[model samples]
Target: MYRQLHNLLLAAVLEGQLPAGTKLPASRLLARELGIARNTVIEVYENLRAQGCVEGRHGSGTYIADLSVDHIIEVPRPVEAMPARPTISHIAPALSQRGQSLIAGAGFSRRQWGAFMPGVPDVREFPARVWTRLQNRHWRKAAPERLSYAPEGGLPALRQALAEYLRSARSVRCEPEQIIITTGIHQSIDLTTRLLADPGDSVWLENPCYWGLRSTLQSLGMVLQPLPVDAEGLDWLAAGTRPAPRFVIATPSHQYPLGMVMSLARRQALLEYCRLNGSWIIEDDYDSEFRYGTRPIASLQGLDTNELVIYIGSFSKTLFPGLRLGYLVAPPQLAGAFSKGSAELYREGQLQQQAVLADFITDGHLTAHIRRMRGLYSRRRQCLLEAVQAEFGEQFEVIGNNAGLHLVVRLPDRVDDVAVAEAALRHGVLVRPLSRYYHQSVAGQRGLLLGYACVTEAEITPAFAVLAGVLRKFVKATSA
Candidate 1:
């Protein structure tokens, strides 16, 4: 009876009748449900114990092993029919699935597999209590102006705070009037893209650049001119004067997708070129605060005496995502135009959130948070690097290690990054494939861009163990 009972239990688990973490009925209850003798159930329990099928904790009943959870078994039931698959032809342009290929953060999930999605801050460490207290205080002392339509330039206090903070931290040369608060840097991108470049106007984009930005330009019908990036950053060789683009977008402090810092010579050349060509340079200073090496790179806006650069920064990377607060420091001449555009179309940013963030920066909370997260992310990067080397050995090479939350893994030409990404997802690990960033598919350079900022050191070992298995399977399949 014990042998028969053990077989039945195993069969139920494998058939998806018993889901992972679902507590088993007590011995008495199980005996009654299956019409078995109490002794039979007890003997079966002992047999399962020996096989490690289930574990019982004090005060907690026996639970199904996580590894034992099988695929969901379809059972016939009278219910509404599921919707059919969406057609590409019917999708609206504004809401189309075109740019969804760009890997942003892993979409929200129920499983706690511990995603290493890029541009994500560890929300567990956010100073929520302090923020809430500040919010409550601001609300209680609110002026009528607080709820009313704000000045298009944004809350004056916040602008002043950001002005001082940028000067000290980013070496930015700007006045309070030059700043305009937007939702985030992405918003700033859209706004600047619309403001600077007309439809069909060419814009220089970093090759293997941030897909999100490229998609935004495409949505606006802006023509993208790919500029190849190497160790020194964007190559200006083929970026000749003909078909001259109206705008040039770059992540100067740390290039996106691949974290290459622009050299001083290149930076000066960029500024000079943009100045002479009358091109508007959009400098996205994303993730500049988390530099592991020397002091953070001085922003291109810091050196912009000719006012060719529009500097953008966001709190989404520094603080939690919910903040949704960011600012753009435009050249003095364009201030009136941007401010008016903000007034007519997108009047008034989030007043309360900006006010709180302004105080946070003013009171030094923002600085402290950056300082703490820098250390935390640095440790996570180190652990991830060691784990990757330990797992893959000479089979892999990592790039973009100096400045961002993530690094790109360059695999052998035989491996396809998209295939590797799919296998990893099946094993409950999430990662971005580097091929996703390429605008036009080019041969060679296929691999994963793994981010470790949001994951814990304890989670790395087990996560990588699963990742290693997936890679091994991928290589095996390709070779076979």
Candidate 2:
């Protein structure tokens, strides 16, 4: 009440509605009239008087201050009163072009956690108590060095822990010295792109790839050549004769959105291609470790004898998205440069959290957690698949490897997947239109990417019921 009155009276004074020397009503009288407590009115007057917007005589009621009060109280201006364009708009900025494109693009959904939200793990299943204990232990012994900026990319202990985990789990041939901790895939991409390539350099990306990867490459002004993926996944030889790209970004462990594993033959061909062309391969091993039937495929980096692959891994899928802790395995020669470059570029530090993560991993909590989540997510995935099958019956074809957080349900060519996604959103079920991931339109591949990882098994069927209603509305002839 006091704040409301203060703002109202202050604005009245600043706009000159209440002229100088205009005596205000008594606190008791104004309070009664406004149906507020007398204290509320008194606090407003005291605050205004302190700011010199009002003055109170010993015996007289408060009055709006003299016109000189204008010198102190700034008048609020309407948003439209400002200039038509920002000052930076006066210059030709390449960043502005990218910024505008990003604004126009499909980004991480506004509602981050919910049914069928892609790329987010079930954070509730994380061993929070264990992490909290580790975090508390770090704070109890609070080392100043640990709290300071991570001068060598990240905490050494965390890097070492990650190195061991990746080596055994993903078959990544990396030493502790080769690991440079990063904020996540985006930062890893940014750091590598900055270090390795100049503007206007060519970057080959998988069509219908992770949207973040596409956005990052586009922002860097790299000429993106999107190669369509098939069952074998992003085959470089299929691209035929063309100028060798400076970088090739591949998600060989499990192709994103579509979820196809790159064949060993294709993986070998890609590595050989990059090695021959002196290009770099950014192998985004985002979430292949959660395979249902068999062990996750070995990383593409494990085969890179020529130091061509930059293996990027993230805790976002395995742990929780909020952790934002990821690591890049740089080639041995560039490891030191990446560490130094990271410090100068980002000045990133959350060393205490990194220390906690290190303790968690080394204590075997991370491994236990991953093992538990694999089972939980696998069950949840089955629940969603069953619901999708029950609702759509074989009318909608669900593609992608039987792995990862999400599944792509292919729509009929004539139906609009975007409309289905939008309508599902209106009914409070989140989905990503598969077409959004493609650089070029493929009407036949129109589908919705449904994430099943974060959603509870019980909620999956109910959510899909709602989504199925939306889909049937958009996908005519399947309306029943």
Candidate 3:
């Protein structure tokens, strides 16, 4: 009878029904669901586990192993051979001082016409009913202290769920103890900055980066070293002569605003550089889930061997921003410090929200929702790309449309991006200027960073029409 279940699972794998690295149902739960003995399920699991069909970690649950022939594939070609990175003898401190006011307000409050607001999920597409159901079920089973102060490391169940999700989706290797949940990316960055960086440490950031990162770091009074980002992504060598940077904040999967994937070679170089310098790397994996091409690129944290990388992620991009749940995956060394800081200062996350998230992850709602949204966003990305080609012709170049909510559109050299963005805003189309993402020193990039995930297909045509008018006005104004 135990062999019966093992054969059933093996057949699912052979037929591609289970897919590689899929999490299997917990033994006890599966037994209950199938009306079988617990030991029978256990025997089945042990057999498959011995055969290498599945793996179970202490505290973490079991997962089916990938038996692909090319499991140990070689790294892809180097984007460009990085020059020997400069060694740091002196402690290069981060230059940007946390600004006079430490607390910065970050929430979506702006409303405008033809809004191509990036980094926002389509709230209407959210599975609210399923979420509500999980919330209801979890509420009934809540602990007596559910409303009281919780652990600073975050709810155990939510961390477990996140650990499992990251393992399958991003290939991130970590346990629940490594996970620290925050209110959003802003909070995660703040917490990490507080943990790893000093008041005046030098930090490396990608040019045309996420404004939120710049605002957050600068507000913390950390010196930001901006590196130019190209089609391949951040120029790893551009950190400039430094008191070696204390941290390199990067969105390697799909760079913020630029939308370019940081190549594998650069990621390795970054890891190596951080290792040698004793500097930490913050892998801000903002929007890698919605790739239109092959499987999403594995995360940078997946490749870190030096324990120098800290991973940050948010569900606000995948789910709704209202959820305000983001997390940090810290190195073992920072784990205790972070826990202490969170406990003494921030405390833990909300019990009800974390409980609902746990249910959402364990019961397979998140996996199902991601599958559904991946298809939806893939279509929307295609539609937007098509619209760009149809309306603007091949003359207007688009960059970074492969995997993210937004991409940078470089207009003709004569056109002024700032003027165009201003004109577009007047027409009720709110596209952001690419220069806004860059620091004041390098703010002349003539492009618009347009985001499409939150915008509907029905809204696309008019949005583009307004954008085209704005572009035309820019051309006219430049010629005049």
Candidate 4:
């Protein structure tokens, strides 16, 4: 009752109902008027006075403090009476050109989880109990080192574990010293780009690359050369006219959005080309695991005897996206600098989480989880393929279905994939328009990227049916 009364009086005073210098009634009078005890009234008055909401004089009764005497609170205005604030154009721009560009070209979708959302894994099957146990084990220790800023190049134990894993699993040739832990693929790329390529330095990018990859490079002011990607992989320097780039980013294991493994010939040629021209290769190795009816593709970095390749891999696709853990295998020469730069730039921390992840990897959980998910994702991918085939038949061509979490369903040149994707979103299905991945304007290879890894086998057919219906509408319009 006292608190309620005190709050009411404070609100009234602040709201300007009980204006400054307005004398409040005596405690006895106020108590009688409000049907409360005089002691309660006196206590409420004392509280208000203590809080500077009210003041008292010896002879005169308590009064509302002159709030306007210092800082004044503006009273609430009626909707129509309030003045309109300036929009982005009217006010000084809060962000720089690069910041604005980054926001405008953001590839992240608001809907992270749903049917056919590309490049996401089903986190439901992640071994939470096992993870929690490892996490808690370290928390129990409460070591200052575990809680402090991560050392240069992140947690050493994680890096050593990753180096062992990469060497055995992906055939990446690197010592533990060469491995630099990162939050994910984005940070790895950013760190590499800043270290290796300067602003305006030519960097070869595979056409129809990951949107995030392209946007990041562009924001950094690197000159992007969009090379055509065929069934074999990125067709670099076809004309032999353009100058060699400082960096070349390729998804050799599985091409992003268009899941084609880069052929051995192409990988060799790219390595030789970069070696001779003093260029670096960025092997994304995107989703090399989960290959349906195929052997694991080796990393391009393993083939590089000259050590020109900077291999980056993300646990986001393999384990779960929320983990935000990834690694970069830098060349022996640049490894130390990369580590120093990562620490300097990001002030890297999260040692405890990294420790937990290291434990997850070393304890055989990482391999075990991948083995389980491989079969599951393979089935889901097949389901999505069958669903698309059942509905669209020969009207759409499904390419890039061999490896990776997602595949591209190609449409006729006349169809607008963006429009189809938008219509699908309206029906509560999420998909990425293939055209959105291309950095350069191209003539008609319109397609949609459908991810099945996150969705169950049952969900794939139904969700794809919704998307197929949307595609059919667009196809009909295109034909007309």
Question: If scored against the real structure, what TM-score would every candidate get?
Answer: 0.77, 0.82, 0.76, 0.82
User: Which prediction has more favorable TM-score, 1 or 2?
Assistant: 2
Model 1 is weakest, by summed lDDT over 10 consecutive residues, at: 101-110
Local accuracy of candidate 1 as per-residue lDDT tens digits, 1-480: 677788989888778898778788899998898888988887777777676777676687787876522433355654888666568885544353434433242233334235657667787888888899889989998888888888888999999999999999999999999998888887888888888888889898788778778877877778788888888787765676566578888898888888898899999998888888788889999889989967899998988899989999988878876677788998999988887776676777568777888888888999999999999999998999999899887778889888768888887778888888777888788887787777674453687878888899998778878888988887888889
Against the true structure, what is every candidate's RMSD?
15.4, 6.1, 24.2, 6.3
Clashes per candidate, residues 3 or more apart or on different chains: 0, 0, 17, 0
Error of 1 at 71 (Å): 56
lDDT of 4 at 241: 74
Deviation in Å, model 3, residue 82 alpha carbon: 54
Determine which window of 10 residues in candidate 4 has minimal summed lDDT: 68-77
The order of the candidates by lDDT, greatest first, is 4, 2, 1, 3
Candidate 4 C-alpha lDDT tens digits along 1-480: 798898899899989999988999888988899898999989999999898888998898888888874365676667786556668785545666777877877887899988888898999999999999999999999789878899999888999999999999999999988988888999999999999988999888888889889888989989888888888988885637788889999998888878878899989998998898899999997689778798789899999999899999999988888888899999999999999999999998999999999999999999999998998988888888788879877767889888778888887778888888899999999998888888756553688888888899878888888887787778888788
The regions of model 1 sitting more than 4 angstroms off are 1-113, 441-444
RMSD of 2: 6.1
What are the lDDT figures for the candidates, one per model?
A: 0.81, 0.87, 0.80, 0.87
lDDT of 3 by residue, 311-379 (tens): 999998788888888888988877878767766667764888988988888899887887788888777
Name the candidate, 1 or 4, with the larger TM-score value: 4
- Residue-wise lDDT of candidate 2 within 295-384, one digit each (tens)? 989999999899988999899998998889899999999999999999899998999999999999899998898888889988998888
